[model samples]
Target: MDTQQNTALTRALAEVPGPLPARGVIHIVIPHTDRFTVVGNHLAQHPGLSTTAVGFAVRIQSLPQGTEIGVKALAARFPEGEKLIAAALRELEAIGYLQRARTRLPDGRIVTRTVFCNQPSALLRLPKAAPHQPATPQAPAPAPTPRPVPALPFPLQPIPELEPTLQPVQVLTTAPQSVPAPAPKPEPLPPLATTPECAPAPPPQQPAAPRFVPLVPPPTAPKLPPRPLPQPCELTPELHRAATALLADLRRHTPEFTLTEVDIQQLAPAVAAWLEREARPDTIRHVLTNDPPQPLRHPAKLLRHRLTVLLPPPLPGAHDLAVPVRRVTVTPFQTCDGCERAFRSSMPGRCRDCRTDHAQAAA
Candidate 1:
């Protein structure tokens, strides 16, 4: 049945409505072996490469050999802008897929050349060795020798001048006055005798007694232990479990790929952000497992992209509404309660002058 339809279509094409130009058509062939390398090389495994970069690389591969392509031209050809195209070119260069070299021409002008490599092994080729030339014979130069500097035979000594004898000048001194001796203290009076004649003798005074007081120690309060520091939100057990699950899911999709705890740590913030936006683990798992619009050579990058772009809107909650609304009261003028003087204040209260005066009076 398919053969009959093909025969009818061939007969219909034989009767053309218009003439077709043969010179306008051109044909080119891309080898299947190079296609595999472009799609599966170490450059393709880079997590930093976006889908736009991969498309850019594909378009570059489709171009003819030794064709000059500018970033702006490529950007115009593709949907991505010039900035992204330039970034893709940079990524390609970094991953050894592309190389650029600038050469100065004999005309004093500089020109840049782009070298594209499909295979990874081509990037590791050693540079060619320069040709060897015969050496010319020449006399060897004499070695330089150092000459010692002469030292003085004896250390130079400084000369001293002779001392001259001089007559001493007579010095006048004042006579010191002698200090007078202090007078002796008077002798104490004798104690009075207990006699009836002495005002009938005063009643024997009672001996003053010393008061005894008890000492009491003040009570001491017990010391409390210091509070522990709060840990980061990423290091929490729930987030760790979520990150482990995410890595496990990625491994399921690409068994050859492996992620370390450091990667998980880096990705924790994005995961936490998604969770904060009320995204569920199952929903995230579904999004990750579903078929992507384009081929994903780097799962971590794709996961990050999806997590960021597909984040749910924040849900209304009591905590969000509980934020205290700052109330601002505007007043043209106010009077002090104590002094009754007109002043300016947001809320009606005592003026600063009156308050200071009151504080001073209280103090």
Candidate 2:
């Protein structure tokens, strides 16, 4: 009886409809309270927009005004390359979700200004046809027809109630009033005999204050700090030439290191100081050319700093004064006692192969 009851319960459960089983790509959505972007289905599910374009539109619409939405900035934040991001931005622009206009600023700089539209359909909608008006008897003066106002692309907020404007209305009266006679004008008396002493002299006019003008200097490139000068030292013609060549050739390693002729001349003396301290040319080159700042605005200043700061001290002792000499030792060739092969050795001995063979034989 218990088994039958259990079977009946199982049958009833199967017959009852419950929650459907989870399927592919189930989403658990959480309601947002703050710091969220509102995206519309028109953009998210646009048939003409590609996936990248749709995503860009959604992100741009959610962003606050003045936020950077340039292709390079987006590429840096996302995994897509600049080319792909630019293409997506173009697609969004074509679909009316994005607009780019070149605006000239007060400072005389021409920049691209971007405007994002969440509801483009409003602007794209056609103007409604004018309402038909019945022909009435023509009057001498006809009122001008009002033009239709175009729809704004952005959503409109509810307008607050305003106080009604008061208009002046003229009132008419139908009453007869008695008229009064106008008084005659008084006769002008003869000009009083004015003596020069009785009449006051015209007041003297004071001179206007000098106009104050503010002197503003014209805009110019910022002055870079002067390149540091190296300590005074006896510069030789050879060292001077080598230093100049090193400074001039820096452009080969990195174009940013390119310096003007005047810059090279000014910086040459510093490089000469490095040479005077027994610094190798290669070391000097590396110090000056290694990891220069990008978009180098002042190459001379940078080289100057490196030259003065990184200049190595003169070699200790009298070694720096003496000429550097490199000595090489040669090993004499010898015949292997066992294999009769010629091999280089410091002292007469068996070659490596003969030694291994002799050791194996002894073992």
Candidate 3:
């Protein structure tokens, strides 16, 4: 049908209650809103399921008294137009119209239904309708006037009692009685005149007693004997000799060597020996990602790694792990130096843990 005739038929059909088959195109538009472009485009895309234009005029014709165009039923109108239906409904929602969709099962029976407000799933505001003066509904009368609201005339009848029971009525009564007045009391005579001479007031209150302060003694920590001073051992003499020799060799040329446990054992066995001498089986402490940054804790092998390793210039030339030497951080994890987290991360340059050493030194 031509757009004008089709629209008229839709308008005519909207005034009455009846079902219309879904043609190849159903254009449901909100009337007075002039949002037909979106619906028209949507309907053009879907050539499978039949559809008819629906607008304010169409809506008025489709809905009967005390009835609404249910979305569930609307969905059922186009059995094969599910995809286009949402687009159609979304157009209606964008124009501030609600939608109801209905479905039929494969066995040719009504099944699922969905009633949705004209809303975007993401919760966008629906466009509001412009000001519209609705047509005044008219009714045929003696002089052609709107039909009056019919009175709901309930016949005058006595109310029936629900069950055999007596309702109690409560009433209040008053009892009047007069109380006797008390007898008047007599006024007492004034005391005889006293002497006019005034004795000097007692001296002002004595000054407040001096406050007594309680003294508190300082807390005394238990005095434990100081740890014995480590004495220079025969091994220490040997260590001094070895250290002096190594220092002398390093002076000749830059030194680079791996100091493994065996190497350390061979050289500075004195410190290890001392540690072994003092080692207690239960004195073990679990180490996490804590690296000893102090030169004193630097093993000979790690120093050698640095000597062999040519780090990327701390300059911003290259990306990735390049960082200011000040920012580079290394922590000890496991028992190896090569192991790192799955994702490469720079170690913190300075550790806050050493702050306690500073505090102790200040004290």
Candidate 4:
């Protein structure tokens, strides 16, 4: 069917007297009323702008205000990827057809606002026109010689030359010049004074002393004193027994953390301080015996250091008191295009209800 249609189209086109198909593009204009964009010839036929950029500009201009024309949005809607669309947008921006401004929201989010201009020249100034000058009168050009006609079967008569017409020349008149004024006579010079007046000379400046900058290193900040180890709480029989058992059991989990009885008595106070802060036995055991340094030297000192550094602060207020957790909804507020109402949406468009209603109506 397509082949037959093509053959018929070719036959009809051959019979008609019109421009050749290979010569150039033939435009078939269709007037649009419902949806249309008025593009300037300067942008449509721009020598510098690429085809993608020109098309992108037209698409943007046709879109209603507040419509999403972002790179990602356009890439999703069109076949071209984000990179090509971004390049086209940049091209349009460079030519003053598109402008993007970053705006920060009250919620600490930054968004880009785009403004499209159909006529860039209206926004940017154009070059001024050159001042008009009167045209100089030029002599008429001579006519070209007639070409000889080919010999025909019958004899032809010789043609006669017509004489050129004489035109009257208008002589130009020059404007009169104004008379020159006479020069005034020179005045006599005054007599010269015997003594000349002179300005006083400035006082001689003394050379500044060559001061030397000492090559001293920059002042360093004072080192902070190491944090003091947690003070041992008052020893109790139960606390002493529990602390001793915890220290003795450390070697079961990690052999490197083995401590002697003398070391246990010495470090027991530090563990008691941790227990006073309400740290759990499991947490304390995990801190000491979970991961010990290789070739352990001074297990008691390592235990003492961990107890001091990893001590937890006492609970504030009543232990039974409950603290409320704050939940922040980070969704951005969007103005619905249909209802013109503000609503929280990750993307811009109609609100949920409006969208549902529209979908039902369409269905």
Report the number of the highest-TM-score candidate. 2
Each candidate structure's TM-score, on Cα atoms with residue i matched to residue i, is: 0.25, 0.30, 0.14, 0.29
Which sections of candidate 1 miss by over 4 Å? 1-40, 125-363
Query: Backbone clashes in each candidate structure, one number apiece?
Result: 0, 0, 19, 0
Could you tell me the lDDT of residue 128 within candidate 3? 40
Q: In model 2, which range of ten residues has the least summed lDDT?
A: 162-171
Candidate 4 lDDT, tens digit per residue, 1-363? 999999977776666566767776654444687766778899999998999999988888888888999999999888998999999998887777777789999999999887777876654354444333323222234323423232234433332222221111112324334323333432222111111234234355454432322122224747667556566567788887888898898888777887888998878888888887778888999987767777788787777778878888876776457677698979999999998999998999999999899999999
lDDT tens digits, residue span 37-64, model 1:
3355544555767776766777787788
Model 2 residue runs over 4 Å out of place are: 1-28, 125-363
For model 3, residues 7-105, the per-residue Cα lDDT tens digits are: 987797686545655776444444566433233333334343234323432442344454433445556754535555555555543333343445888
Given candidate 1, what's the lDDT at residue 88? 84
Q: Write the per-residue lDDT of candidate 2 for residues 1-363, one digit (tens) a residue.
A: 999999976776566566535665433355799998888888888998999899878888777789999988888888989999999988877777787889999999999998888877665454545434333222233434423333335543433222222111112323335323333432322112211234444455454432321122224647767546885388889888988898888888778888999998888888888888888888888888888777789888888888777778777877657888899898899998888899999878899999998999999
Instruction: Please tell me which predicted candidate would have the highest lDDT against the true structure.
Output: 2
Q: Give Cα-based local distance difference scores for all models.
A: 0.59, 0.72, 0.38, 0.71
Alpha-carbon lDDT of model 2:
0.72
Regarding TM-score, does 1 or 4 come out ahead? 4
Task: Give the runs in model 3 whose Cα sits over 4 Å from its true position.
Answer: 1-61, 65-72, 99-363
| Rank order (by lDDT, best first) | 2, 4, 1, 3
